[model samples]
Target chain A: MSAERLLWYTAVMAGVTYLIRVLPLVLFRREIKSPFVKSFLYYIPYAVLGAMTIPAVFSATRSLVSACVGLAVAVIMAWHRKGLLPVAIAACAAVFVTEWLMRML
Target chain B: MNAAERRQAFKTGFFDGLPIGLGYISVSFTFGMMAVEKGMPAWAAILISFTNLTSAGQFAGLDVIAASGSMIEMALVQLVINLRYALMSLSWSQRLGPEFNLIKRMIIAYADTDEVFAVSSARAVGGKRLRFIYMVGLMIMPVIGWTGGTVIGALASAILPDAVRSALGLAIYGMFIAIIVPPARDHRSVAVVVLSAVAASCLFHFAPVLKRLSTGFVIIICGIGASALGAWLFPVPEPDCKPPDLEERSAHEC
Candidate 1:
């Protein structure tokens, strides 16, 4: 793509993104009426997180295995309500160790 | 919320964003590396990371750059990948003080990353004001980490060993886990998480129809469809509380 085209594309996407993000705030104001919409909205984060993570973690790729281990440990830590830092550290350690172990095995 | 309490919301939002910043170092590093690999300038990669504060959009944008797509294509890609932020921003604005004018709205909108949105949303439900302090509350460390990562990624592409770089790449996926699994314990949310992912994977892998579609198009279809369906399936009960605001009326109530 031409430089001009790329910049234009970026600008337009930025606008759409900003608009989409800001519009509901502008339009809805305080009225998120449908309990269904509210409930569904709650799940968007999970849905995005899950769909994004799983494929990365379990696919037939090396990093994926480490990612799974790190994630599993992180979940356990968070479920127990550990601080975010420890969970993140332990999970990252899990990935590093898993990768190292795979190399040894 | 009083002065002290409003201050506490900033603390909550800030710390909530803290741990995740660690994971960003590696991911943004790779993103910067990849962006440069695709001929995006070092400064451009860093700028994108700093401004967008998103993983999915940057990744898709990188692909768009790789494809040498038209400017329209690039923007559409960003729009599709980032559509979720709209929902997040909407949920947050309601929690803002009525005094919040255009400027405050603009600041919060710029800082609305996934972690910020998540933490701010939680506090907002309690009807506490976090968005005002919310930008300063959550964004400083992350902005530093992301920008730093990109700088290193761009400069270190040749020096970093492939195996080590590849290993570190796993950190991004790990970060996603930190973001996802803890929240999935709730059943209604869990089902949404599982199905949406399964659907994204299946649609991408099996649906020859989608193969021709751009990354931007695919994400929009998946995100909108999954979110809409999940909403249809399990709705949250409306809170039965007096006055949506969470600040105690009496000075002693807090």
Candidate 2:
């Protein structure tokens, strides 16, 4: 891509993204009063995280087997109430070990 | 707030963002490599990462640029892929402390990536109001990590090891799991909301017809649907309670 073209596209992408992010923060200066809206907003982060993780997590590693192993380790450790760092590190470690073992086999 | 309190808040946010910044390096490294592989200049790839600061949206936009797609196509793709940020920004605005004004909101909105929003919203949900300087502190590391990784990857994609690259894919998802699981375990309503959203996402991913939808739409649908379900089933008590605005309101009648 030409430098000019790339800059144009990047500007458009950034503009659209910034608008999406900025509009809400700029517009909604007051607290929203609706119970349902508040409840929906409250639950949104969990809902988003859930939707982002599933099926996508299964494809995160080089192989599905390793990915599943990683997911299992992550879920178990997270379920045990481990901190974010340990859980993330454990999942990566599980995927690494699983891939190494598979390579040997 | 005094200088000491300001420093403490910044330190806390900096630490909170440290791991997230590390994760961004891995992801953005791939983005930079791919953009270069597609015949983009290394500087161009770095520029995209520096300005956009989004993961999936940038990836999709890279495809559009590589294919020489139209400007409208680029904007539409970004709009769809990033619509979730609008929802997050709405929630985040409600959680902002009195320190947040229009200027700070504009500046802070630039760093409202998925992981940042996740961390900030988690803090807000814990009943703490988000402050302006703390958010500025939280944004610094991830921005540096993202841009730095892109520069390195675009210039040295061939030098990185395959093993490290492959293992890095799961880091962000693992982080996501860590964020959601503890809360789900605590509240049955949250658990139901999360599980339902996951189920819906799976349907969109694998089921006939629905599987054709783009990832952006899939996420937006599942998130809003499941959240609406939770709202209908379990409305939050005292939704009018503004934690940041009124201190006495904490003890006020619901």
Candidate 3:
């Protein structure tokens, strides 16, 4: 892509995303009014989060090993409910190290 | 509410996000490395980190670059993928500081993320000032980690191992586990998460119609579809908030 084009796309993305983030504040100050809208909004995040997180975990290989390893580590951490920092470190380290060994063998 | 309160939110928001910063670094570091591998300059990669603060968008954008997508394609992908931020921001707008000026609101808007959303949502029902604080806690560390990771990855792309790179590819998958699995043990987010993922993947792999879709298109379609369904079925409130019964929630809900 051309430099101008890339910059334009970046700017547009930033602009659109910003607008999306900001426009609501501009329009809905007190609270969203409509019940259906409210009901729909309720599921939107869950749906989005579900959509975003799911494909990442279980596509292509069907091996839950990688996902499971990361989950087990995270659950242990979040359950004992240690700090997210420690949990992240432990989890990322475990996954990376495990992948490393797997690759080696 | 007051200057003192705003200051408090700032401090808490900044500190609260510290741990998330570490995770952002590892994953985003890999992103920067991949950008370099794909021929993006280090500055470009770092700039992307500073600006986008999104994992999926960046990864998809890189693919767009690889495919030599048109300008329209690039813009549309970003628009599609980042559309949720608009809703997130809108939801947040209701809760964040009422006194917030347009500029402040605009500047801080893109700072919303999953973690930021979590923290900000916690305080949203109470007041704008508190929401702002929660947002602050959520972002301070991520910005540092993300920007710093880009620079490091861009610099060390050549040195990073394939094993590590592959591991990073699984970061999203790992996160799903963290989000979905525990909930499954009970009867929780497991169904929605599992269904959405399986549905999308199956579509991507088997559904002939879905095969023609770009990465951005795939994400948008799957996200919008699954979220729409979950929304209809589950109907989480606009706020979707917990009623501050922390003790009860902690014991049973998660």
Stretches of candidate 2 off by over 4 Å are B239-254
Q: Mind sharing the TM-score for model 2?
A: 0.92
Per-residue lDDT for A7-103 in model 3, tens only? 6656655565556566776666666666555544443444444455545444312235654576567667645534334555566566667665665
Q: Write the per-residue lDDT of candidate 3 for residues B85-192, one digit (tens) a residue.
A: 767776666556555676667656767765455434433432223344546556787789878878888897656565554444444334433443433344343357
Task: In model 1, state the lDDT of residue B186.
Answer: 40
Greater DockQ among 1 and 3 belongs to: 1
Residue-level lDDT tens digits of model 1 in B1-254: 48886787567557766755655777788888998888877777876777677777888877877787776777666776677778677656556777677766776677666655654543444344444665566776677777788888987866655545444554445445554444454454456645775578557645787666654355445655676776676554457211232223212221
Clashing pairs in 3: A20-B86, A42-B236, A43-B231, A47-B227, A78-A81, B13-B136, B13-B137, B14-B137, B96-B128, B97-B128
Rank by lDDT (best first): 2, 1, 3
Candidate 1 per-residue lDDT over residues A9-33, each given as its tens digit: 4566457666766666656566566
lDDT of 2 by residue, B120-222 (tens): 7765643568878789888998899899889878999877676666676777777788878877876788899999999999999999999998888898999
Instruction: Show the lowest summed lDDT stretch of 10 residues, model 3 chain B.
Output: B245-254
Better of 2 and 3 by TM-score: 2
- Where does candidate 3 stray beyond 4 Å? A1-9, A58-64, A76-83, A100-105, B1-12, B63-70, B122-130, B158-208, B211-254
